[model samples]
Target: MDLVRHLECFVAVAEESHFGRAAARLGMAQPPLSQRIQRLERELGVRLFERTSRQVTITEAGTLLLAEAREVLARSESFLAAARRIRDGETGLLRAALTPDVSGETVAALLADFRRRHPGLELELRELSTAEQLAAFAAHELDVGLIHHPCDVTGLELGPVLHRDLGVLLPRGAVAAGLDEVPLAALTGYDLVLFPRDSAPAVYDDLLTACARGGYTPAAVRHGRGTSFVRGLVLSSGAVALGPRDTHLLAGPGDTDPDLVWRPLAGAAPAWRHSAAWPKGRGDAAVGAFTDAATHALRTTAGARFEPSARPLHLRPASEYWL
Candidate 1:
């Protein structure tokens, strides 16, 4: 008495126009096929076929139901196909968040490549601090995050995506003309502009440790939430900002910020690192596909290789950093 089974029986009989032929087509005995049609007719309060010793004919009611029944079956099959596609990661939505300082060139290239590989997927991207990205991932609001390195990874899977030598962005004329690299010790007396501690504590701590190794603390510190804002502060307030070597790309083309210049930091400065992270144990197919694409993009387009960290940098013993 299953409705779909009844409809199938009805459709097969309606198309074949003979119970014996319908049963042969359905690979069933003719008796059961006849009984199913009778049950369907009784339920609908209409006879669906006219049977004679010489021939069989479909009733008007059977013809109408045949069209509706075929549509239902077709739609059911389409639904299953769509479900399979989603399971296979052939089509879906991916939401990703990233830290503001993540390189624009890297992100754009990665996105373009991923889109080419997964034309059916819809990508939603947002910029957030490392802390915000972590929170969003935990809340299940985000599928992936691009964050600064040395982050806490207690309940997440993370791998490095990019590494670049650190540099200092100083106000124009802050140092003697033509100085290519500024020694860290020379920055001891200068006020520094940096990201807030809570936004990326590990990166903030790394900066502090780097300065401490130079034999002095900064004279003063100013907090900013984004690299652009920090750079602006450096330009107007004469405070130096520490960032990646490619930080100049953040500047608008042809907008001469003659007030700002980038100088590499001397003496083995800690590298600016970025990582891609996702929730631990998440088995979403789209997330898996995206991770694979991101891994490839990082290796090829970004020219960075992922080296798995056995333990997060902050979790390591102090001796590790000292050595």
Candidate 2:
């Protein structure tokens, strides 16, 4: 007996409560439907329905099996739909977005690997503001996105992969004879290079929080919209910028600052958590691969190198706060 036919016959009998009516619904002869039901019962080794001259009703097992049978049929339908899509060669485009602070080094290596793995798949990228990433993802413009966690979007899920801590990047030549580490209090005297107040308010607000904890606010030298440019100014102007773990990445961008150095500040390490997020929808293989690549890169790049960030990068409880 055909498995699907058995399930269909069982569903019909279970619903109509009579073999003749069930056969009418199925547009088949009554004997055929009855035979299908008998075959089904024999296959399962149990009766699914009870019948008498005056009434027909489902057994306890039949009532339970009704929903399960529907679910199995739905799953099979979905599987067939997916196979048809693949056969049609219309796996479809994948849409994505990301935070600007995530560098080529952070994601490029994984993208290269993905390209080698899936050359035919076309990817659409939208370089967006953090707000744009949040809004677009919420609106279904993107298939998946990369962003820092702790964002305010109400209906999205974040899968974190990398850990990045904010650093106080001081000019190389700045002297610290007495202080072993760069204390946030000492930041008041230097010209501060920082991110734009609007572009990353969370990061900027966290900076103020660190300053308040440290007992003073630093004066600004230059502030910018781009993370790359912030590091650039810090290197050349001998000013301070909130640095991230990937600060050394500045070396490749022609940051001629021979004197650039990172000073771990005394406060909660700012969260620069990077994650791959997707809308709550069923995704295709490429989306799965993208999320996996993101996770793999985050795990590989940050697993051991970023333990210091897991805890707040605050002052060492009883030891020197600088590293």
Candidate 3:
């Protein structure tokens, strides 16, 4: 028997105190309503009603069960409503990550926007590189990630790609920094300061390829995972790091590394592409919200732009360079 249905019939009959009236109120035939009550009574081993040709009355057992039945029905409704809320992503935990190279301002803007758009969602954000995010996705430990492109994304779905033209971050006193814009061949002898290759191998290799194509191959490539560390290398080691024009924002407030300057390459030689990624077939409203917020933050705060004719995303070989 459908227990809830039987309970409804029982309650209706008890309240109406007449089989014909109860059946009409339930929008069912009197015989079926009576049969359902009989089945419920058989399953519970109790007679729920005292009936006669003249009148029908709820028995003591029915009277005691009526309140409990109503409570169960209310709880069922509450359970379904809660399930729907979660399905709609109205209230739940969303595990999200961002690449470390994203500027602080962009991260802050994304957080503020996501919170504003989805006040009920609890966001657990983490700083992870492209490779680390891929691992997290594989392990099912992450929900969504703002990841750098030109990396492996075989099993993931991507959001719209945003592009940021890269410039060289060099010591302010360097001769090349004196120029309004730095040409690729101008700093031939300097080493390159870049993030560890393992952090994002494809992007790392593709960047090196682009530099070589522009006639600016470095003497050596030095790895620095943090902005301050990259700046230190550029200052003390005579190396230059590639970054967006707003790379100074990575520094703390009132602590913009005055010794370092970002100069655009003559042709925007190398650009960084980014997009939101999640496992295929796993997107939900929370993920979509994060993706939208990330795109907006990257464009506004990170000075990123979307290409009108963006190419398909895939792992490009290090032998080829892309703009």
Most lDDT-accurate candidate? 3
1 or 3, which is superior by lDDT?
3
Per-residue lDDT for 127-245 in model 1, tens only? 88888998898788998877777777778876545666677877667762247778877776678887787887767777777777866477778998566678778767757778765
Model 3: residues >4 Å from true position, as ranges?
42-47, 247-256, 318-323
Give the 10-residue window scoring lowest on summed lDDT in candidate 1.
314-323
Give lDDT for model 1.
0.73
lDDT per residue, candidate 3, 20-55, as tens digits? 999999999999999999999999999899999999
Compared with the true structure, what per-residue lDDT tens digits does model 2 show for residues 1-323?
67876897888888788888889999999887777887888899888878787767899988889999988878878888867766443355667776666555756766775566556666786666566787787677887777654455456655544666666666666774124456677767767665564554554565566565776565654776575677667666656776665545345332364556665655555546666777665355676667666666655654413334453322222221122
Q: Say what the RMSD of model 1 is.
A: 3.7
Question: Measured by TM-score, how close is model 1 to the native structure?
Answer: 0.82
- The CA root-mean-square deviation of candidate 3, after full C-alpha superposition on the true structure, stands at 2.9
Clashes of 3: 0
* Candidate 1: count of backbone clashes, pairs at least 3 residues apart or interchain: 1
Scored by TM-score, the top model is 3
Clashes of each: 1, 4, 0
Residue 288 local lDDT, model 2: 69
After superposition, the stretches of candidate 2 with alpha carbons farther than 4 Å from their true spots are 1-90, 116-120, 176-181, 235-238, 252-257, 266-268, 282-284, 302-323
Q: After superposition, how far is residue 185 of candidate 3 from its true place, in Å?
A: 1.9
